[model samples]
Target chain A: MRTLVGNHGWATIAAPGNTGNVADFLVCRLIGSIFICFSAILSGCHAPLSANNSSRVEITYWRTLTGAAGEGQEELVRRFNNSQNEIHVHCEFQGSYSDLAAKLFTAAAAGAGPDVTQLGTFEILQFARAGLLVDLKPYFAGPEAINTKDWPGTISTAGEVEDGLYWLPFNVTVPVLYYNEDAFNAAGLLGPPTTWDDFYLYARKLTVRDDNGVVREAGVALWNITWPLISAIWSEGGKLTTRDYGHITLDDPVVLKVMTEFQTLVREGAALLPDEASGGHRAAFKNGRAAMILDSPAAFQEIFAQAIGFTPMVAAYPAGKNGKVYAPGGGGLVLWAKNPATNRAAAWRFLRFMLSAESLAYYSQQTGYAAFTESAQQVMTNDLKDSRFGVIHDGLRFVRGDFSINMSPSVRNAFDEAFQKIMVDLADVKTTLMEADAKAEHAIAERGI
Target chain B: MTRTSLKACGIRRRPRCIASQWRSNRSEWLTFGAFVAPNLVLFVTFTYWPIVYSLHLSFLEWDLIEPSAVWAGLGNYARILNNPQVWRVASNTLIYAASVVIVAQFLAFFLALLLNLKLRGQTIFRTLAFTPYIATTAAAALVWVLLLDSKLGPFSFIFARLGVEGPQWLARSGLALVAIILVGIWREIAFATVFFVAGLQGLPPECYEAAALDGATRRTMLWRLTVPLMSPVIFFLNVSGFIAAIKMFDIVAIMTKGGPVYPASSTYVYHLYKLAFRDFEAGAASAFAVLFLMVILVATIAQFRAGQKWVHYE
Candidate 1:
């Protein structure tokens, strides 16, 4: 067409004679046609481009993870930001576990909260019930909001309420018995105690006292049980709460039996009150003060810290007399102070980053929180799995649901209070629990919890 | 010419003085407001704002996470004021405070007098005595804990050698409170001792010489002459000691942590700490804090009124 225009230009110049010189005319036509055609195509593509636009979204995530895992968490965030072009996340480490909860709550009330937080298991239920979380359905759209296929059952199942999913376990672990091998061998014990009866008898055999009447080494602590005391009740076929969420089933016969047995251990001085000198049970086991101690598998780092002194043996959460096994442990990630727009978005982004396989493995090795996802546990970059924490992934298998997770903290605080009294006051187990049950019931009613 | 100028200056002096007085009256207003504004602003910000906020919060049922605090009139206060734990904690606070102040001050004052006698290693002893106060509470508490250990600590070893069994300092229910109190007193009395030493040194030598001429012994001089003259410093110590003791938190947290089987170790501040900070029960904790403030106010005013008898201002 350009060449034809050029050929005709000489005739048309003024006589409608062909336009201009042939080469010059061809150049103008070619340039004009090319610009017009491409401009039309660009205009037509605008709608779809706008529909599939990629704009940066930010999420401000607050976490309580400190110590070693804190380092890995920052790495995960950095990688996540680098991996995605459309989103950037900023994660801040607020102090310890309890400190972050308080800060998040205060920020929430002030309407200045972060988008996400790594909350402890017990704290999640309380905060979630306060209507402080974004329903995953809105952000994620369905029950498969997060890919739940690789997640352990108890870890994910507990968070799905009738309306929405409240929490997700990014890093999860269950408590397991850790024994100092050197101490066990010295005591002539064949292996770590597997059952309560065996544990009690082994505890007595391990007991040793200095001439001063103060215990040189306690076998186990009856008084201190952050999780196992509750686990003990669950193990003996007792439930912490009823289906109605009102009854204190602590008065059940099986729970009483365990309590009585625990009391007997206390009376015999086989178990002891955790002393400051012992630096808690973890330290107790490390220092040879106690041969056996029970705590979260998250404590594997501390076990690692004690690598010079003792070799820790991690076993399954022991099964009880009724053959009912319970892991009175669980943990999950929560979005805190994420009450509003910008912070919440950023928090969600960072949370998603933590859920990714690489990020989870990176964080798992840093903190002792075992990966609830199979992808994470299989390939840890930290080379620490051969230590005590490697058992954490399998240990999460024992976690069972008890609705007591939703009980108000007043009840939990009261139970701890009552438990301490029953332990130190030397009260009869049935009589003490009956009183505690009554007290707890009254407290629940009084608060209408 | 000089006589006339002097007469003129005398006549000018009266009217000029009156004029300057009016000018200075405007400056007085400026000076007064300038002096008070800074303090008033700080008080309104840090003190009044928090109190007002907490008072409003006392009516709410909101946790820390909620966007808005839910109003729950009289509910939080009723829950707390009705509970017997409140009273127990209050009484425990009084006991903890009184025991710490009274026992610690007595020991500190006596030790200060002993150290002021120009002994061979008075400087070393003074530095060593106050060293505990300089240490972090957790570190000091940890050290004491290790020192008191029944199995490993030398204290128990010595006690055992003496044919007496030592108490479980932190583990036993009955002994836990005593153990923490001892820790508080030991760490705190060091500072008090140094202060007492300064006050003893400041006492007029004339009083001692007068007592000596009158045939009084050292004990007599301490009871009559020194005590009377040093009463002002002692009064200051007592007031400050009372305030510090009631605020006991670090000792209990580091050593006992409100435990050894009971909540009685939960002093007012510690309980308030656990609720407001730990449990996120802001409204309930605020009410408790306000009530505690009132109790402390009453005790303080009563102390000032009663001090006229025992405290010699002169």
Candidate 2:
């Protein structure tokens, strides 16, 4: 039998009196193969660079849009890539606004994240305060700088915090009223309601009941979110909070009055409050179960595309007592402050491309978000003339985001809970609002807001 | 003579005995170490390290975006305890957990007994019962949402036919929690049924034969022999079911998002997630996590201690 023996550091099969040449050969070959494999892996790990693009700066951009909007964003990046070979941007679609914010925060804490990301209006102040955002004002001074005069004043200044412009408007949207024209014609309404009283009366008229008294079609479907409701509250001469968020006034008498009217509509079976599981109010309107809905223009494409057998029309939100004061809704671009100087410059260049008139117009037309720039509106002149698109853009001039208390998640949660209790549970409006105010104050103090 | 006597008497032979033992068991010890090393390393890295770090974080205030944290000590715990929402959320969690566990186990045990009977299409029944446990929870939840719609759902059609308005299962606060509990029971019954069936099949026939020979009734045999023999499975199902129900997050996240009002149907993990991610309060979330861990630990220990009375080892 052959015995195994150790010589120096090698194990070998030892014959009676022979040197283990085969074992040595096998061991040497194994080590050689491992070395070659490791070398190949290391060499293959380098980023693929083409001959002409060796000097191009690579940067990452995280956006929070999907479907047609996502495709529009991708097309813009593609055009920018083809326009010049100086930079290459890798655009990634992060999930919804809240999801993106959560990931961005954790990533920023680790000193690593995308070079640029889309930020919601509510998140701008928080991020800027935390020093995670780069001030865009510094980048707005060069030859390629954006001309703020062309952008709507409210949209342009929405990201201003502590005198620094940390976010640049990209996909801006304003809430608009979508009504089923067929239902409106059947209800014998001459035109869209111009006042809240007309809106209430119109809802009652449009509501269709069967012989059994079950509502076959609701008159209006209220979106169960707080965004569109903000416009209603503001139009009624009610403020959610002060400009500085020093005090929350959700319990204001005017706010209660507006909410009570809404509650009355629901109680009267003229309005539908569809839950998210039921496809929200949008689906209710699309399926001919509801005649009208208040939603952002961002929902226009999908609503029109899916509202079969009904002529979905766009109209301005019904004016409240103080006339319409709309709240701007949508997201903007924010550069990460921790990016290297070279990457930051490349990211800014990409962001500038994204905000160009041509790109903005293309995105707005594709996604139903309003083109916030004059040049972009000029680009879409024909489209803007259409009644459906015209009504959506009309609210741009009246948009306001001064009520920033909704920026606090705590306060927002309180408002949402209070709204749900009033609408769904039919709780006492005054008591619920009072409780929400107390909750918001407690949260504000606890968070040192 | 003295040295030899001492060595043979086990006084001076202790070192040699240990050496011999080590030498003989060296390969066995190495094999055991090799087998356990990977799991140990993984547990330390993913579980232990995070738990220890969370404990450290609970003592400090951090928003998770800032570079440094402020020392808050027990302030987070104190604030969490004082927050009324915490009590509301805790009550919701307790209600959900207790309802899911007791109802699910009761139904699952009966299902297991029914399925264990020698009926036609037994294989098909088993597969049907187990399908929900294997379905992707998020996808299943979305489908459930559509099925529970107040106006357009099948239930609404059925209710309309009966001349009654369908209850808004997911819109009303109280009914929303009930709907969640029903879904939890539906999902959990599959898991518990499969285990119970297996345990039933594994039970010894000798005990039942002995019971019959002793002139015991079928009911007596079932209650005494079968149940006693199946106590371990029952114990396991209750313990695991309670833990899973308490930690439920995905269903609530997809179905209601703790809605219709704050803390209406929120569970512990869902509330903890909102605190950490939504509110950006890492310290308070960590404190919440620590408290949650303690509650789960105490509950599990209590279950185990009570189980010792009835759980039989074969």
Candidate 3:
């Protein structure tokens, strides 16, 4: 006789005279199935090793650009791969800068990360200090050595920390004044403001009000982010931080003066401070709701595309009393130090290809990012003739790429809160700045940054 | 041996009887182990291990990329407690959770009552009411952003018709928090309503009829008969809703980003996220996680204790 027992469609046959043997068989089968499932799931976590069966060295390159710029980066990699048979590069798109940094940190902690990654200015210092990035000085003398002199001094040297060059500028940007020419024409203004004083006056003149005195068109819209505000502060002869990151000088008299003027602009209804959710300052400028905005040239493509019915134009940021000293913004490529020597060499070759003059020029033409190399700039002679791109390049002459205090998260958070209080809440500038300085100092001391 | 004879010789027969029982039940135990092994492994690997590791990390000074962690003891906790912004964040979290739970629960209960009535197009009403809950949160937040824009939003149009300007919903500190809370309530009401509808449907009609014979009005019947009978669902919703509200991050992240000013609309979890990811303060973030866990555990325990008096478990 045979007996069948089942639960949830799982069944086992039991011999009438030998039930114990049947039970053992059922148990063993069940356990074996579980192990099989577990093995399959774990196996799926990673790709089969070198499944391509090629002798070429495989390297992974993680990038943080999207849309047209992302496509440009992909094309550059494709060209590099086609140019060489010994190296096969797989380029992956990691989401935004912060997202890439987070993934890199986790991957590094686990002893696994991409061979090369595009790192932002904020991450280079921390990652370098932690000894996660490769020192490229050794690779500078190889057959694929890049001409460092062709790259801008400030930008190339910005990556140098503790006698090690860990980063190379890939995409560079600078803040420029974006304005509506029609609004300027209506206000009887010619060209962009040349001085901060003239800029304030132009803002007031360009502002339009309805019969009930409601502002229909704001004269200027402040980006309200730390990057653009750096220019205004520096133009006023203020320093956000010392070169060594030891002191946060946010409460200096020059900073107070600059911040006070910004507060006055917002308080007097000449400026609009739109938050990120309300499309930010870019959207305000694009929609013609605001006549002027200070933004990075990286926004040129999006702003122009969206600013329909208006002749959008770009100009150099207004000069302060001390003249034009602007901060350089954007990200750079850094090779991870954890890779094997062969992989590292291949990654270096890929980096050299990306930073080549032709590649840089092509990238800049495709994206609004400024070509940082002199050779790349020379290659793009005709593209630079456009006033919008030319104005962005003009700001590059006085770009300061030092690791300032704003690079520290604690200090940046403190300053951002202070800025919001002064600009949005109409708080007293002096007191707010002083409080922020103290808070930042305390946090810096505690964090030991 | 016969059962009476075995009982008389209990000590001698006990071992043989136990051996026979084990022989019969061994397969069942093995099968149970086989079924449970996979889930147990997963839970231990993913959930329990992370909790344990986070607790360990809370005592160290590490930036996450460093090869080794330095001993910090309670330094992370001390810094968190000393920071002034932390208190504001905690207050914001409390206000958000309380507002969402109280407002959403009441609105959900009211809608459930209306929907419980045999009204026309009830299925459509139920589906419409629950749509927001199923809709993607990030997408919904983007829509809310446009609807609340001070200059071009629909609300702005209405305010303009009344000879007034619409308040800057996301640009002002107080209004920003209110806007986030409103979105939270909107999404949460749908989930609570579905649960409430189910509970209402399952309620016994005999209780209400008995109350009516006892000269109870509809209001009294609802209060005395229905509420007690539905206490188990109510208890579940309250506990779960509060927990969900306290961890609210997506709407705040997408809509306000804890901004217009720092900590203006930031919640506890968002603050913790910034510390870990943005600030690179892994130890401090871990400490925050541990503290958050403790708070949740204590709050849940307190709720369960209080529920003994009100929750009906028939």
Which 10 consecutive positions of candidate 2 chain A have the poorest summed lDDT? A11-20
Worst ten-residue run, lDDT, model 1 chain A?
Answer: A14-23
What lDDT tens digits, residue by residue, belong to model 1 across residues B1-314? 47578788774334457567656454444444445555676699899999998888888886556556778999998999887877877777888888888898899999898889988988999998788889988898888888877656888888777766566677777777777788878976987898899998988898788889999998898898888877777777778788888888877777777776656466788888988887778889988888778877887888788777778765
Task: Supply the TM-score for candidate 3.
Answer: 0.93
Query: On residues A351-405, what C-alpha lDDT tens digit does candidate 1 reach at each position?
Result: 7767877777777777777776777767773554465555666666666644353
Our tally of clashes for model 2 stands at: 0
Model 3 stretches with alpha carbons more than 4 Å out: A1-13, A16-53, B1-26
Q: How does chain A of candidate 2 score by TM-score against the true chain A?
A: 0.89
Top model number, lDDT: 3
Q: Which of 2 and 3 is the better model by TM-score?
A: 3
Q: What is the lDDT of residue B133 in candidate 3?
A: 99
Error of 3 at B64 (Å): 1.7
Lowest lDDT 10-residue stretch of candidate 1 chain B: B26-35
Residue A423 in candidate 1 has what lDDT? 69
Superposed model 1: Cα runs more than 4 Å off? A1-58, A142-144, A160-162, A209-214, A276-278, A307-309, A321-324, A328-330, A337-339, A342-346, A380-390, A401-403, B1-39, B59-78, B159-166
Please identify model 2 stretches exceeding 4 Å from their true place.
Answer: A1-52, B1-39
Looking at candidate 3 chain A, the ten consecutive residues that score lowest on lDDT are A1-10
iRMSD (Å), candidate 3: 2.2
Q: Pick the winner on TM-score between candidates 1 and 2.
A: 2
CAPRI grade of model 3: medium
